[model samples]
Target: MYIGRAVIAGYTNEKKVFLGYILASMSFPKRRARIDEESIKIEPLKTADYNNPYITYNCMKKVEKDKAVVSNGIHTDVIANKLDSGYSGRDAIAISLFAMDYEKDEYNTPRIAACFDNRSLYIGIIEKEKIIIDKVRNDRCMLISTYNKTVPEEISIKRSTAKDIAKELCMLDYEHIICSAVVCRREENDFEFATEEKNRL
Candidate 1:
């Protein structure tokens, strides 16, 4: 299935918090994930495509030690800013998704996001026809995507390390895998991060 872009938030069997983002694009597959000390950005390999709004974005942001935000668009930074400004994970995700609505692109692509802290996890989607925000169970992995898998669904993630988790997400049966980024809690306010690109597989 081509689930476009996806976000996963949950806890590993060891009870470590983890968040991940996957870009599965058929239209813009020439993209790669760039991870820094603070965030994960998806960018086009070709400089000429840098200005294309839909293809370049900060897909995940670390707001604080224990708080992080993940999304398919600019809303990732928006939600992270909201958290930095004192909103809870659920509220930040809900407000940002509501304000951004869906991407105003040719497909009217829905904006999907996830925000999680040490205590809670929230996933949201804003589509042209409706908006849904869900508080997910932290004991298990939950996934939300911009295309067909817009609703949050539980998925098993047995991998406990950030690098393995990223590869696991990229290796999912989803078609046209572009790239993936993942973060796993390491200590109070610290996380281990990794990224995987399908072209290297």
Candidate 2:
């Protein structure tokens, strides 16, 4: 799976606030053998590193810094702790990206699950004791690292919402995969399980 970070608008006590989230993509494993669609299964990801301060605070600030936004009023350490415990161990995060073919409430409150067209990013967290980014290609995704501030900027982020970022990144990744396909292989199998893993260098 590809590992990265992002900011998502979260609600607390009905108050809207921008919260930082560490995002990852979870897909089918490459090393596994495939059977009939119905019989195929994969292991559910387990995580114990939810309280990772480095990911919670640093990931959020990295995205904000890309937009030239100051990381004020953000408790890099405290919020990190919250994310650790708040994690439901859920894989797919259903985020609203586009408008759906549905109506809004009378008060114009948008329904999260129904009224909005959404895209989901699947992910999992590795051991919190150590975060290692490897450069390798697997059936799941390729891990990519962001440029270090102590060094130079390798990847740049444009100002956009999490939904926008997800959609565009998905598209960017799709395009690259399509362009790199071999014609002979294309005819042999349907291209369905494909993804990119972004990581920190």
Candidate 3:
């Protein structure tokens, strides 16, 4: 459980945007049991004092040591799936096309019951709470690959600990490997990302 503020610094040095590259899941990566030699050089950064501005309101307030208002750290989020049970983020946006409501042609459509649609819907519910989800970036983007070709048991156990997996990925790549949620800092131009504490669905 990665419980504190984390700053994942890999190769997201893009001037005005954040990026993520998929890393193979330790248990299911293609051929290799570990990160490829090329992807292992990426580094994870420690977010010092609310460096990432995409955390929960309570988290941001604690970091800022300020008053906690309803909107203290609220913002519109565009959540989308970065991985599937068997794929990585090589072309997440293109892949998300399937998450959209084909009938409505809306990306991250509010209603779709398939597991894939479920992931997109989960993001939508997060937005209802005022978080922003980035759903529109087409073609060849970056992601920390976690779809490693290990064993299913190892993968299940690893996925259970979001913080640890996130930390591991952060340690191996650039850009913040955002989970279900991240906090937006009021003063700094950064974000505090974490998975949702409450995953009802």
Alpha-carbon deviation at 130 in model 2, angstroms:
10
RMSD each, Å:
1.3, 19.6, 18.5
lDDT of 2 by residue, 107-186 (tens): 22111110000111122112212222121111122112211111111232332333333333434431111100000001
Let me know the TM-score candidate 1 reaches against the reference structure.
Answer: 0.95
Best lDDT goes to which candidate? 1
Displacement of residue 71 (Cα, Å) in model 1 is 0.4
Identify the superior model by TM-score, candidate 1 or candidate 2: 1
Summarize candidate 3's per-residue lDDT along 1-201 as a digit string, tens digits: 211122111112132122121222221112111122111111122342333322222211111221110111121111122332333222332344334322231222121110112111111111111222233232212221111211111111122132333344444332322322222222333332232312111
Runs of candidate 2 with Cα error greater than 4 angstroms are 1-79, 82-153, 174-201
> Which pairs clash inside model 2?
2-197, 26-122, 50-84, 144-199, 145-199, 145-200, 145-201
Better of 2 and 3 by lDDT: 3
Model 1 lDDT per residue over 1-201, tens place: 889999998889988888899999877777899997789998888744544687888988888778888899998999999998989888898889888889898999999988875578888889999888888775888998888888889999999999999989888999999889997887778887899987777
Off by more than 4 A, model 1: 47-51
Worst 10 residues of 3 by lDDT: 69-78
